[model samples]
Target chain A: MPQKNTLIYSNWWKYAGAALVLYSLIGGLLFVNPNNLLFLDETVRNLNYHVPMWFAMISLLCISVANSIMYLKTFNPKFDIIASKSAEVAVFFGIMGLATGSFWAKFSWGTWWTTDYKLNGAAIGELIYFAYLILRNSVEEQNKKARLSAVYSIFAFPLFIVFIIVLPKLASNSMHPGSGDTVGFNKYPLNNNLRMTFYPAILGWIAISWWITTLLIRIENLKSIENTDEN
Target chain B: MLLGLVSHNMFAQTTENPFYSNGKIYVVVAVISIIFTGIIIFLIRIDRKLKKTEKEINKKNQHKD
Candidate 1:
């Protein structure tokens, strides 16, 4: 279990997050979308669902990378456990983002997959993280595994950002909004009603993602503590 | 208000696309349902993890006894 004073041990935020998520679902569906984009009419509501996955992923991965840095500085096994578990949750969110994006593309772009820079970049970025997990598993010695994985995570975070955010913008064409020529939802697509749900949705999803990561970390702690006791 | 009128007009208008069917409201339902299902699946995973941990703890306690 996390320290009693820690956010992970606190129950209020988890309940708040659940309430916000439920509100977002109902309000997201009910909110009026004023923008009448050609292909993305009613599906504009997907903004509340799809975009938040990436936001949650990025937030959790930021935590993961921060913990990795902490581990490198202190060589603490606890930090390494936190780093790995958060990364695992972040990858789960990234996969959700990819799956939802693919489904959205099928309707709007008229294809399940496309040659677009952002889409390919997102996929490749996930593959890099997958390699990070594989890298963690291949090494056996506890400290060595933690040290190596932390270093890999530190190096990979920048590359992941470049692949998902930077490369998409640098490329001449991208189907995704806020990249290439297409303006973000803030410019025109999102009106006040949509914003009411959108911001809360992102916050809520990120909160839930962190909650899940903390749970995983607790489980890891329990198992590792048991191992130490037996040894 | 003007915003109300615009939204009413928005809902009044309909298109032939599948997304626009039932004033495109069902699309929102579908998206919400998918997300709900995903959350439920995550809950199930957490439950399984808790169960495994409980079993481990029980085994350790038995050994101590």
Candidate 2:
């Protein structure tokens, strides 16, 4: 029903995403880790599953905020729908990322939750978006709801970036990778084995995120159509 | 004796992979299963939503008629 030519709505991408994710799931299990790093050991395979989740979450959040900005500029209700639904999917993936990370951490760090900067930052970012959802539901008027949430989304995104990306790097003795004094995963470049699985997983997750958001948009459209029919 | 032979063959096959020695392969299986389960649940939720929407629209059409 959209007049615009957006790549997100395409069926081919959905198929491709499903295929890539299936491939990654199989590969992540079968492909042998080259170095077999310590502490991580066999759980290093979780990198394909756990890390791509954060990548998908960030990508969805980026799409959500971009649509929010577009809504502000054009004031289109459709953009509002896209923005909100994308954020909803983003939150879903973020929670999954946290849960998987916690599971991984329990084995790797010997704790389910840590006071690490990155962990706390990710928690705060998730809370900020949860607040954004609460703020949206509080308003009844359509335009006002969209405008306020759009503004809030734009404001929160930069804080999210700072929390998840910047603050972790600044703190010393943080538990996560790429933090101060820690080499992180980047210490060893992903060899062909890891790269083959990793890249496909990222694409698959992003595609799945897009597929879910579009389904949500379609549902919203149906509701709106029903409302108009009643009128 | 037959049961023991089957169990021994299973164990031998599993032990063939060096990665299986650490019991880490099960972790990989668990993670993949969790992801697949999550996706299945999501699909079911969407299907439920679509069915509800269809019923509502059909009821509205009947009322109009």
Candidate 3:
């Protein structure tokens, strides 16, 4: 048996949020607001929040896919619950990311919607996740629903990567900087302030997403138990 | 600009610009976000407690049966 940790129920993310706010204030006072810090461009200011959302969404999708694959291997309904709830959280964050990204674009690029590679790729990825929900719902049989959802979620992993990866390379026009240009990912400039805040924001968002997903899964499991008893 | 000089040519509507200089909008947004998180947390707790209660009820019924 695995050792039960008391820390599991601890509200760690609340403390993490406090630390993040404190760091943001200190960083602003010391490194950012001082020395006339113009390192991060005005538009890139939103990147601290928005970019991390995309990263977190992708990470949640990955967990959903992994749980799906596990369900396929073990033929377990428990794994299906994990997969479904994770997918639900992923889709929620994915849509929110898209909405916030559009807001950013509106402020920075003078348009609410654009054909930029990142924007378009994200739209398609949202559609793919939406399809997973639609597919699971349209089916009737309990076992077939679980089995088919598992199989479909497995395919989403590769399809998501392919759709997102291909857009940046395509000759299609994009308003995003370095869209058509073949600049190496590492060599592309990210200012020091952005580097520090961006990575931690992604980590924080990932933790928060997992927290939300876990809550949803427990609720779903409770509902299932109720259903079984009633039947 | 989406926001521009308002003219009397258009009928005056205070609620139309609810996001004016008033801090009310910000406070409302903050409250909503907090409430949303609180609701999710509350739902999870309720679900857990209900499940436990349901189990106990079922157990009592089973013993009677």
Candidate 4:
């Protein structure tokens, strides 16, 4: 029943760990052919990990936001915990995405921080997500916390879309691929051979990270359920 | 994507592109982060519901006891 299912989440690490190992091996094979890898200079290899992670992270956030809305609608405490837990997993991935991306940027853009539209927009997003976490902590009332957080989460999603998507298009031109007037957005063309590796990298990261984020939500839900029943 | 093959290009030992900076790195990173954050916010609600059910169960048990 619920108890039996709870065990599944507790042991999620096994699945996540195994997936990581598999991805690493796959990455290794792609890395073996450095010359033909995407980005041409071995720099695009970061996309395998970085790009997928960003997708996984956002996917996790999307789920979390949905859960938050449910909490507000149903006034359910369990929803809030699941939402919080998912955010934790999301944050973990997000930070990694940022780090790996910044590392790539240093090589691709000449500096860690750039004065371009896309970079600035991203920094703002990082701050907003960070603020989302902080805002959650600042509140104590269960009812109030759930309501306020839900409101904030909903508001934030659109802002993210605007900053990450819309604004970049309307702003200044950037050397950062497909940002401004770069016909077809920043879809950096990956070589066919490299695409073989890079595309899978995206798939692998998303599959693995999505599983972990789901596992985290399940764990928090179960643990909180146990705590309440015991009391 | 700019390798800056110009004369003053950064002295990259190999014919590697010296001008290629991680400019779009932030956008990619932000997109990743935004997605993750969205997921967590959703999960929080699920956790709260589970807690509610647990609470109801406990109340029933207390009355029975």
* Tens digits of lDDT, candidate 4, A1-231: 234434234435434444453544344333323454334365655545566666767777787788888988898776776676667677777778778777888887678877777667766766777888899889987678778888888888778767765788787686555466554312534332345445555555665565566556565655665666678
RMSD of 3: 10.2
DockQ, all candidates in order: 0.20, 0.14, 0.04, 0.04
Among the numbered candidates, top TM-score falls to 1
What's the DockQ of model 4?
A: 0.04
- Candidate 1's residue-wise lDDT over A1-231, tens digit each? 323437655557766777687778866766545356556877887888899999999998899999999999999788999999999999999999999999999999999999888999999999989999999999999999999999999999999999999988988877789888776777874443677788899998988888888788877877786887689
Candidate 4 chain A weakest lDDT stretch, 10 residues: A24-33
**Chain A TM-score of each candidate structure, as shown:** 0.95, 0.94, 0.81, 0.79
Q: Return the lDDT, model 2, position A64.
A: 90
DockQ ranking, best first: 1, 2, 4, 3
lDDT of each: 0.81, 0.81, 0.64, 0.61
- Give TM per candidate: 0.81, 0.80, 0.69, 0.66
The candidate that wins on DockQ is 1
Off by over 4 Å in 1: A1-5, A189-192, B1-65
Cα miss at A56, model 4 (Å)?
A: 1.3
What's the CA error at residue A164 for candidate 1, in Å? 0.6
Error of 1 at A41 (Å): 0.7
**Clash tally, candidates in order:** 0, 0, 0, 49
The pairs that clash in candidate 3 are none
